[model samples]
Target: MSSESSKKRKPKVIRSDGAPAEGKRNRSDTEQEGKYYSEEAEVDLRDPGRDYELYKYTCQELQRLMAEIQDLKSRGGKDMAIEIEERRIQSCVHFMTLKKLNRLAHIRLKKGRDQTHEAKQKVDAYHLQLQNLLYEEGKYYSEEAEVDLRDPGRDYELYKYTCQELQRLMAEIQDLKSRGGKDMAIEIEERRIQSCVHFMTLKKLNRLAHIRLKKGRDQTHEAKQKVDAYHLQLQNLLYEVMHLQKEITKCLEFK
Candidate 1:
């Protein structure tokens, strides 16, 4: 009978006040909240491997949410101000990258152009120096040639003058020869006469001889004049020849 009674008795209760079952159930629920929290802590500690997966999922979901927000903004939704600000930041970052790339390209192009310009300047300078050197060489040759030509001209003139003077002297000598022959014949005829004839002949002979002597003297004087003129001409031609030779030597030296 005692064993049957023990089976029918109520078990020991944590909340014995029987106000309403819902109220007691609420109090007991509050009392066990820490235990529920402790059990969750134990599960989280035991599942540390899930942390990386959770982080990855969180990131993917955030990206998806951002994409949805962008779509909503495009469709003219009212809650797109945040999305617009985020897009503006991304656009600024892309714009700055593009600007930096463009600046680097421009700098490279400028450097290439500068190098090309400098190379051209060097080439031009070298060519200009070569041209100036050639011009100077040409001028030197021309000046030397001019100097050489001038000396020969004076020599030619002198030779021509000598020839003319020689011709005139020969003409004078022929005239003197004719006069001397006539005087000699007159003297021979006067030697065979006597008295008044002799006197007249002698007078004619003396006159003829005087005229012959004058002609001979005139011939000698004319010959001497021609010789002196020729000497002067030879001297002038020699001077010119020597000068021309010197100029030719100078030209050779230049070469």
Candidate 2:
């Protein structure tokens, strides 16, 4: 019993010593893991002078990148505005050109209408002139026919008076020849001769009347010629007026 107790006690003492060594090994391993973790997670300690220099460099780089982005955005907005303005200007120019063309076409149409109206008025005026001329010509021809109708009756009366005067003259010449044969009847014959001389004077008066009748007939013929010439002149004037009216009518129709 004593020897068995000694063996058990000896194993216990050795186990106790091993326990101390194991505790020491575990403590060293824990320390090494803590050291490694601390080194891996450690924050850099700043040097005051170097810290300020690095901060300034980082701020400059950030400002440069921000300024470049802002410049690109500004340039893009300006380009877009310029393109929009150019399109607007082009549209306005095209609209103005179309408006001017429309105005010109309207003016041309108005001018054509005005010319047509003027031509119509001219034709109307010429037609009125032609009608007036024709009326005047008709009145002149009617007056000339009335004068010609009156002339024949006047010529017959003058011819009958000339024949009566010739018969009286022949009777006077026979009485004078009978008076010359009787000498003793001188006084009676002388009275008969005086009667005969009076008769001859009557015959000479009749001849003078016949000459006046011939002069009147010649004057009437000359008057008729003058009237004919006036009628021809009026007819020519009427022709000219009619021709002008025709030309004006044609122009109006064409318009």
What are the lDDT scores of the predictions, listed in order?
Answer: 0.54, 0.54
Separately for all candidates shown, the number of backbone clashes (residues 3 or more apart, or on different chains) is: 0, 0
For residues 1-255, could you state the per-residue lDDT of candidate 1 as single tens digits? 999999999998788476666534676767787455433223223322243344455556556656766686778865677777776566555455445444544553464355445545665576568668978788433323343344445644644554554455444433432343434333422221222232333443445445556767988999999999999999999999999999999999994
Clashes of 2: 0
What are the runs in model 1 whose C-alpha is more than 4 Å off? 1-70, 139-255
Q: How many clashes would you count in candidate 1?
A: 0
lDDT score of residue 29 within candidate 2 = 74
Candidate 2 residue spans exceeding 4 A from truth: 1-184
Candidate 1 positional error at 167, Å: 80
